[model samples]
Target: MKEVILALITGFIVGLVFAGFKLPIPAPPAFAGVAGIIGIYLGFKVMAWAGPMFAEFFK
Candidate 1:
């Protein structure tokens, strides 16, 4: 359980940092870029955080 939570938190933070830093990446979608991965992960993390918080208050 602890490891899962830690993984979640680390993933979230790393994703945010990646997006915030806006590291350079090549154009075109054909590339398996690290930046792209970070962006997607950040999107998922944001959704995860918002979903639970919003649901709790609304219910």
Candidate 2:
């Protein structure tokens, strides 16, 4: 769905920002990938929780 796609995109963008800023600590490429994975999982969970609103808006 659109909301899932949007959440994934946003998560990727956030991961990029986190990678750039060195949040928590400086991380290598592998760590950044881990952060991206975490971001994606969290994003999807959040989108699922917000599904009703997104379904109404995006549909």
Candidate 3:
């Protein structure tokens, strides 16, 4: 997707700049943290999709 590519490119640029300046990268420093963020996003998406379905079912 366009958004995904743009995000990756932007992150790469920021990372390079941070490295050049010897500053810490501003992001989760571990895979588990990244996974948790992804899990949260998925949870939100699932609720968004299911909320309407359940509402219609109960009506």
lDDT by candidate, in order shown: 0.74, 0.80, 0.93
Name the weakest run of 10 consecutive residues (lDDT summed) in model 1: 23-32
What lDDT would candidate 1 get against the real structure?
0.74
- lDDT tens digits, residue span 1-59, model 1: 99989988987787677678995323334456667887899998997888886786766
Question: Between prediction 2 and prediction 3, which has the larger TM-score?
Answer: 3
Predicted candidate 2 versus true structure: per-residue lDDT over 1-59, tens digit per residue: 99999978987888888879877533345777889988999999999999887797877
Per-model tally of clashing residue pairs: 0, 0, 0
User: What does the lDDT read for residue 51 in candidate 2?
Assistant: 85
For all predicted structures, in order, the TM-scores are 0.38, 0.46, 0.83
Q: Which candidate is the best by lDDT?
A: 3
Which residue pairs clash within candidate 1?
none
- Local error of candidate 2 at residue 13 (angstroms): 32
lDDT of 3 by residue, 1-59 (tens): 99999999999999999999999879999999899999999998998988887886767
Question: Which of the predicted structures, 1 or 2, would earn the higher lDDT when compared with the native?
Answer: 2
Query: How does residue 8 of candidate 1 score in lDDT?
Result: 82
